[model samples]
Target: MGTGANCVQSPYHVTGSTWQTTSTHFRKQHTPHSLMFVCFSVGWVQGSTDFGVGFNLALDYGLASVYLENGTTVDIAKVEGGQVYKAAMRLNDNNIGMINGRTTYSRSEQINFKQSFLDNYIYSPNRLGGDGNGNNARSRALSLMLKALKTATESYLDSKISNAEVVVPFPASESYLHDLRQAVASVSLHMPMSAQPPTGIIAARAHGMYGKCFDDLDLQGHDKSMKNDPEQLILTIDYSRAALTALLVDEECGVFENRRVIHDTRLGLNGLHQLGSITATDLLETALRNITQLPLDDGNGAGLKYISNLVIIGESAGDPRLHDTLRRVLSEQLEPVTTVKSGFSPPIDPVFAASRGVAWDCWDRMNFQVNE
Candidate 1:
């Protein structure tokens, strides 16, 4: 049931009871006591080479280290007396194999090492371009990240006791979650392991959109006339749609609640603004509260329970007032959510900015729904 390099192995078809047994086996065997954190940052290019300002946020945070399964012998040291062996380590540790017609080592030893390293470093298909063309640049990058995660988890487990946990950081958006899930599924399909599928890997936000900002009347206008005014609601949704799209394309695929946009519109002008501010403050507070509750072991434990690293990103960041408000909100809400100042630069280049903005406008015009 092993597929070659480019394809992932499909999950085995089993009876209902067998499926349950498999699931339980995976949970029991793969769950780690220590957490492994992996962070991913998404962004678009800016003007010419300037690229304006691309949103760069930590994608993973829970795991301590990532291990490459395959080990490359970089250097050969000579040990004198008890250990007097000296040799040179090569920089480019290419795959071990016969170069010319000479037999470098015995067939048995060569075969054994080749099998071992192959098992350690999972092979990934590399294609040109990041435009999401099948297994293109984006997929390659994802594969590399997954391989690193797999290697890291195995290495950590080898040196430590069982029951250690692993954490993976990602955007909280549905799209991001989908991408990550796909990446993990891809890895599980390719990698061969004795233990069941790895579990206990928590996803934390490295950068997130402030739902309050999109909900506020100051930013997103609302009407006070009708009870459930469709016109006013439409305007608010449009504004939110624009803002969210701007942030996503410009701010490294930041996560925010689409429901908040609908809620803000339903509340009307004054109500929306007040609620937005309150929600923003509450989000910050909640983050801080969770930070206080982190387990006292290694830093990994904190990532497992709560987001330890924070990167704020958006188009509103250009405005001094909005930027200050966001900083204050984070300070008040989540004490542990570290605000890394990215200055006044825009996350995406100007060229893409307008396109992304237009995309938002189109989506809003069509009345896109979160469920959709």
Candidate 2:
């Protein structure tokens, strides 16, 4: 299962749903597996929307659709819905859309819903080692999120998952990542838990970026361009409401290389949403400068000089208002550079793109393990 600021995704086995492997190399059929990728989303700001990918997945495959929760499913196009930093969940038998937003709650419920936006349980210096009441709610909320996914997954699989691996966004700190891992373990759903990778040292963007570079035609074109010209670079932006991650991609002797994951705290998604247009524009300008000016060695004496493609992703990137603002600001900044061939483009299904990419990454890893 993968949860993002905008959506929760699982590889669900939709009964009678047909799927096409992007790569023809995989067309030689295997023992059919029941799971297909699905996404559930909610509005980020207002916390008032809920939808799923089941109906569209079924419709796309010309299969009969089945409702798993509350009979709500969405058009595949709606995966690009502009919402960020909010997770969708079922609470008190009713669906909760804005898990991240602040709302009034009973003293008991406050703790659980208070830190709902982030998977990391906020801890103070005093509560670090002691299991405090304040920590329980956040922990429980995380568990509940996992429990919900497990229930849906098991229902679709018709069996319990013995070992479940969750791919979480690479967090800011190691301790926070450890806390996130522990939260999943505490759920005790009888599935051994694992996270994508350790925190801070890597970027969650890597999984999606690698997945895209693996097959996505547009991204593949960038790779081919890089192979022909070593100086060519691809800029990938992971634009989530919580944070913005930037990566530089290149091809070294026909092999795709993710050069580095750039970190800039000043470019956080919450900061962008909270700031006025002028301030946000300024922040974006600074971010663009930071992105284009990354000090990466491309083996040539000249460092990165040309960006062939720019892939914008994440739920926030899909927001027309935000997208326009950032694009306008970025265009203003890039006009002087004059090297990047393609300008900013809104991500294709920004919400599910990352989750689907992550799913592909997991599938590859699992296949590797099986072959090994």
Against the reference, the lDDT scores of all candidates come to 0.22, 0.35
Report clash pairs, candidate 2.
12-36, 13-34
What does candidate 1 score in Cα RMSD to the true structure? 25.5
Each candidate structure's TM-score, on Cα atoms with residue i matched to residue i, is 0.22, 0.49
Please list the residue runs of candidate 2 whose C-alpha ends up more than 4 Å from where it truly belongs after superposition: 1-141, 170-172, 188-232, 249-270, 294-296, 321-348
Instruction: Please report how far candidate 2 places residue 244 from its true position, in Å.
Output: 2.9
Error of 1 at 332 (Å): 11
Q: For model 2, what is the C-alpha lDDT against the true structure?
A: 0.35
CA shift at 18, candidate 2, in angstroms?
A: 35
Q: For residues 120-142, could you state the per-residue lDDT of candidate 2 as single tens digits? A: 33433234442542344434445
For model 1, residues 1-372, the per-residue Cα lDDT tens digits are 111112111221101101011101111212211111212212211111101001111221111222121311111111111000000000011121221121111010011223543322222223243223222322333444544434554453453211111221111222232343455455553222111111111111111221122223534455533232110000011111012110111011121111011111112222224456767545433332322332222213332222333432322224343345445533433435443321223343211222222222212211221112
Worst 10 residues of 2 by lDDT: 55-64
| Top-lDDT candidate index | 2
Model 1 misplaced stretches (Cα beyond 4 Å): 1-135, 159-182, 189-324, 327-372
